[model samples]
Target: MTTTATTAKDLFLTAMDRRFAPEVGQGDLSLALAGAELLDLLGARALTLDGDRVVPGAAAALGDVLLDEASAALVRQPPYEQVEDWLWRRGRDLAAAYRRALQADGGLSARRSGRLGLGAVRVEPVDSPARERAAARLEAAEPVLGALAAAIGIGIAADTEAGQAAVPAAAALEDEPVTTVLAAVMDAVMELEAVRRRRSIEEAAFANIWRAP
Candidate 1:
């Protein structure tokens, strides 16, 4: 069976192939995948962001289970949540799910092993011409794919170099509705990151300030 990538989720999974580490916190990867999924839906006109809310667009299927599920979730839920909130809340083990899906599609291989004396699984891409082509396409900054790459880069800024390179390219794209939306999403995610960092620092300071007398 020839494995192919047709949606942003697929492309993101391909980019993540052999790159994700089990030691890394899942939250960053999950949010990054969520960001990629959102961009894919936006590129497909499946969803749109109005201010902070995610406005549902056409419900046409994208033939990718992850993208379809994300679309359905947006469609079924009210547009009361901001994109960042929705993403953080909904993002969970997204990278793992996509990797397993890719493995099932013959696009990747997985093996169980022990890491740091703990059980762990390692996944790598399978040899496939279609997979290579998809990876190349992702490497090249192509419209929706480029935007999705940028979103992932922004989402996991501290985790990977790919995200670092994606931000400028995504920001440099010509102005369009989708580009605008991508920029907004990036800003929202960044703001959330900032807030998280600040809260962590504040919590640490409080703990230190309340040390036993």
Candidate 2:
């Protein structure tokens, strides 16, 4: 499983493209990105799954800078972090981190618009082998990526008009660890949505009380 392209990176690319998964909220996308990193760590043999807990293996400097950072951040002790816990901890603002990393590597380019072409800048992915590979994976509906993308509302329908996978990609995965991570990501994402809804309701209620006076 010596993969050069990372799931996190692919997820970022997909997020950037409006055609892939538009309307994805940052919180859910961040959780999925963290899950993607964890999956890559599993593939790289830098970590192993003990039940739903993540067990750190030997610290390896995975060639990607952000991945190496993820490896260094692993909980290297007994009572290792649970998959759900890891998603919350590592997933906080993870999307912005990937965006910055990609911009640094020229993987992203900002295009400005206006009469003088200097108004708001829209960030887009650059042409690179990494992006090409990620696009290929999405189009082919590679299970791990398809499941992750699906978790964040990006569907296999992005690839096919029939939108018929027979079964959902996540349910169809044979890889237990990958499946576990995907499930955790989905749960965390749902939890995040619930939290946002609660906050929004509370805010609205508070505003209404002030208006009543």
Candidate 3:
């Protein structure tokens, strides 16, 4: 299993493994993935956190297209993008983008099955070194990755007692930059939940009004 890859890629593969789980939102996953990219970049010293604002370092080709693209996408000017803002902007439809990238790279596959019946296809992870490496990290509770996966409500999370117990790796991530990204991911998830709930309530109220003739 290859250890050298984007954390977001690892997290994405792990999440898709739990694809049948309930309440896993694509938008939230996207946000978490974006945060993962930042975390990975921080680890590479490709960038650093100036408080919540991201300060870009010297450009480096990260050997991964997505990671390189993420580096290039950084706001180079003053008053650079904050963690939360970067999450929303980069997270937009990011889940699908990741899926496409992975599928193209043969990290993911679509199999037509009877589950959805007829032409239904299910996307599954290929038996690749990348997938194996990600599973190993999750299995070992690798701190940043475990924390990132959990933030998206996949694998283990702080919300679960076992997740809390399992992640000594999570505890290892005590540095300011790591904590900053993790906290921002959690906040973004909460905000996304609030948005979903608000829309649900609004739709229900609208239906009530429509029926109130």
Candidate 4:
């Protein structure tokens, strides 16, 4: 039976929520199992029954047309059965690291770390002559934007509320540009922009990686 696209989207989001939501601890085994079940349904295994024996095959028939290398790799394995569970395990491990970072700094620095990882994985390597030129253009634009943001006194505190609330405790002169309330707001905005870009990249990579098989 074919699973609805809506169902797949729900499963994907549920998996993300369980794995990444900071308030939630590492996802439990049950959550992992549920995620696996959703993948199974979508993978559309053709199961055959012979008395008490059951066999699963035709794994690719169930998914969409865009299977990223990561997702495709899962299908090629024998226990195509455990693909979702494998994904859950990897996801949980990633989440655990982010949680630890947040717990330590109470900031969103982990989000930046996540971006670096995604960019490393998703940005295709190319030797084309135009590639270097394009990269140079992008890099050149960074300072312009960074300077603009910095000029506005954007002091990106990873955990703005937590960090800002601690700022007033300092007995030193509060006249520093970075110490102003506006600086705190700009810092929060920078952190927010970083998080938004990182999340967008991650989600896009996820979709690209898991496009139908």
lDDT of each: 0.61, 0.84, 0.84, 0.33
Global Cα lDDT for candidate 2: 0.84
Native-to-model Cα distance after best TM-score fit, residue 34 in candidate 3, in Å: 0.4
Q: Clash pairs of candidate 2?
A: none
lDDT of 2 by residue, 64-104 (tens): 88898889999999999999999999999998898888888
Q: What TM-score would every model get versus the actual structure? A: 0.64, 0.90, 0.89, 0.23
Q: How do these models rank on TM-score, best leading?
A: 2, 3, 1, 4
Tens digits of per-residue lDDT for model 3 on 91-137?
89988888898988888988886856667666778888888888878
Query: Could you give me the TM-score of model 1 versus the true structure?
Result: 0.64
- Measured by C-alpha RMSD in angstroms, how accurate is candidate 2? 2.9
Displacement of residue 122 (Cα, Å) in model 1 is 1.4
Per-residue lDDT of candidate 1, residues 124-174 (tens digit): 667777556655555543555555544445233333565455556556667
Model 4, position 130, has a per-residue lDDT of 31
Which lDDT value does model 4 have at 185? 29
- How many residue pairs clash per model? 1, 0, 0, 6
Score residue 44 of candidate 3 by CA lDDT.
Answer: 92
Tens digits of per-residue lDDT, candidate 4, 1-213, equal: 122232222222222231212222233322332232333333344332222122344544444221221234343344343422333433344333433322343221222225456532211212333333323322333222122222223222435442343233333323332123223323434544577689999999999988968
